[model samples]
Target: MAEETADDYLKVIVFQLKEEEYAMEVDYIQSIERMQPITRIPGVESFIVGVMNLRGVITPVIDLRKRFNIESMEYNEATRILVLNKDNSEIGFIVDGANDVMDIPASKIEPTPEVVGGVAEEYLRGVVKLEDRLFTLLHIDKVLNKNNEEKRTVV
Candidate 1:
């Protein structure tokens, strides 16, 4: 008989923030591209950089660093925007740089620990231990929910 293996898997899109690595489900990501000009929206949340014309569609961009309360860094060669879709709404997330796509098996993923720095427990989905390194998986829905709630309260 063949040994049964856990099929727990996630299609993740990895990216960099500061010197750490993070990832989110690919299904939530619509597109990825280099940083472009943005139109600032007055009175909007500071985390919200502005809106961008994405192939004729105006999409709001969020600076993930600010959203997470991390110190902001200037855009560089590795900077890119990760377009995400949630609840039928498209939102763009600015990331430091994008890495390769990785399929993480279920066994490799574990519940996030409490000691991870610069990351809130609510925003984390899980921790994937790959080789000797750890990758933080983000819960996009939770993050977006918090953003939407803040927007509503402000309006």
Candidate 2:
């Protein structure tokens, strides 16, 4: 039998955005929540939808659609907020939906192609294939750092 290192497989949380599926490693995720009321903030990037209280901790939320330059869609029952811890604070990303947690063998992960629709290349960590479905693995740091926007003061 072969040895299994921590890098042998990637455990990820799969989510949907538009018609494509995306994945983010579970290690970075804090929680996944159903759609909730968001209090809009003034003078922030258009992609930064607003902020919402997550169990009494005010967390800033950003619409991944807008962040990826994809057209906006109305929030429905399927929408979700993926909360993550960043710099001792919490931030959330609004996604179309999050529906899977799976382990994709590292062998199945490929370097991102030159052109993948919906999200920009910099935001992608790689492409993963599990059976017949493909998942775009997102580089969460790059996704949130694109604009180098100042971190908002969480109340």
Each prediction's whole-model lDDT (CA): 0.86, 0.90
Residues 41-111, model 2: lDDT tens digits: 99998999899988999999999999988999999999999998877879999999998999888888899
Best by lDDT: 2
User: What TM-score number comes out for model 2?
Assistant: 0.90
True-structure lDDT of candidate 1: 0.86
Worst 10 residues of 1 by lDDT: 146-155
Q: Which sections of candidate 1 miss by over 4 Å?
A: 1-7, 147-155
Model 1 TM-score relative to the real fold: 0.88
